[model samples]
Target: MVAAALNGGGGQAGEALLTLALPKGRLAEEAAAALRAGGLDVPGEEGEQELVRLLPGSAFGRDLRLLWVRPADVPAYVREGAADAGVTGKDALAEEPQGVLERLDLGFGRCRMVVAVRRAEAERWPARLAGEAGGLSVATKYPRLARRYFLERHGLRPRVLELRGSVEVAATVGMAAAIVDLVQTGATLRANGLVAVEEVLPVSARWIVNPVSLRWKRPLLGELERRLAALAAGEVAAR
Candidate 1:
């Protein structure tokens, strides 16, 4: 089910344009800024409930179609060929990497995935984990990554509970012994009486391309890469 509203393209000619899946919300502003910084003109009329839009070649130096989707859905769109490329979180890529080639780190939306627990149980985390036997349960939005982390890093077999939101409250309410979640600041965790116990993965937005697109549209994709790479380098250097 592709839940996207397309905007900006005209006629059969638009089908030949390079398409990109751009995440909506906070990352939308950042993605546009990055594209503009790369010297591409981003122009489009905002329409109510539009998820996909096009920028005419006359404005952007190339006929470009943009698919606006929820951040988490970006990878799926690219993988499924709904888009030739996309901007999404590294964590999302990790969750679903098949059929996608990670092209560049766009250098925005930085955060970390971590294992957190109620503050009162911070010191006992290690011992508790060790003593839990085969019944250890962990709550997270990323069950795949969380289960892998515990098994590979700690050698613990855990029952991973996947939740759509509010993973922080898992431990307090006894839904699980701990939670693996993304954190930009510890403010929310602390407010919920939780503290990070282990670092899982460092995350940031990434530019990804469909493998088939890479082969079929090499020149255009390369040019896009070159422009975006320059901006990424500048960001790295300024940091």
Candidate 2:
């Protein structure tokens, strides 16, 4: 299954190959496993191997091209048509520059995009933070969504400080009043005395394609969209 998604298919669909911009971490490996489980042949061991490949098309007319890319870069690759489509987090789509489009969801890489503030400052949550004269200062890896969520939800404009990493350090140095980041287990948040008071969005790895290429690459993207959608639906029931 994982082997097949990485390779190409044959038949009338042969001329048009659907390439996927796959994430470079666990989601890539997990997605490959899921595709393989759904009868897509799995290939490539992602262990020490970082390079992505396109294997030979099989007789059943199932062939796919998978591209290896950083998870954050997946959207731009798909949106630009550098690859036919991609599997990336919803968070990636949210943070992408403007004009983002994706046709379907792969339903993997479950996580949340949340707004975090210092644990001791729980009383100063969304509403009160907005009342301040200068507004609450925020530090986030995702300045785009944070800004959007804050303004839309709180009716306030915050001074957002975009930080590369160590968002907790930003709070300690008073660079920002709080932070917004991806929270999976809340373990890191607990360690830093930061807790999520607001949630921006729920995120998952999804199937994304270029808006223009949707028609030109219908055979590849269309088939994948159907199969993956079904798999995602079934996965929901199972859960």
Which candidate achieves the best TM-score against the true structure? 1
Q: Best-fitting candidate, measured by lDDT?
A: 1
TM-score, cand. 1 vs. native:
0.88
Q: Write the per-residue lDDT of candidate 1 for residues 138-167, one digit (tens) a residue.
A: 998887888788989989879999899889
Candidate 1, pairs of clashing residues: 5-52, 7-52
Error of 2 at 33 (Å): 1.7
lDDT of 2 at 103: 65
lDDT of 2 at 74: 86
Per-residue alpha-carbon lDDT of model 2 for 1-239, expressed as tens digits?
Answer: 55644443321223345566778876877777666665556564453164556554631364555668888898877766667667788888888845446666667778787888777777767655857567688898888888888888877678888987778778756667878888788888888878888888998887777776677767655766777788888777776
Off by over 4 Å in 2: 1-15, 44-48, 58-63, 97-100, 131-134
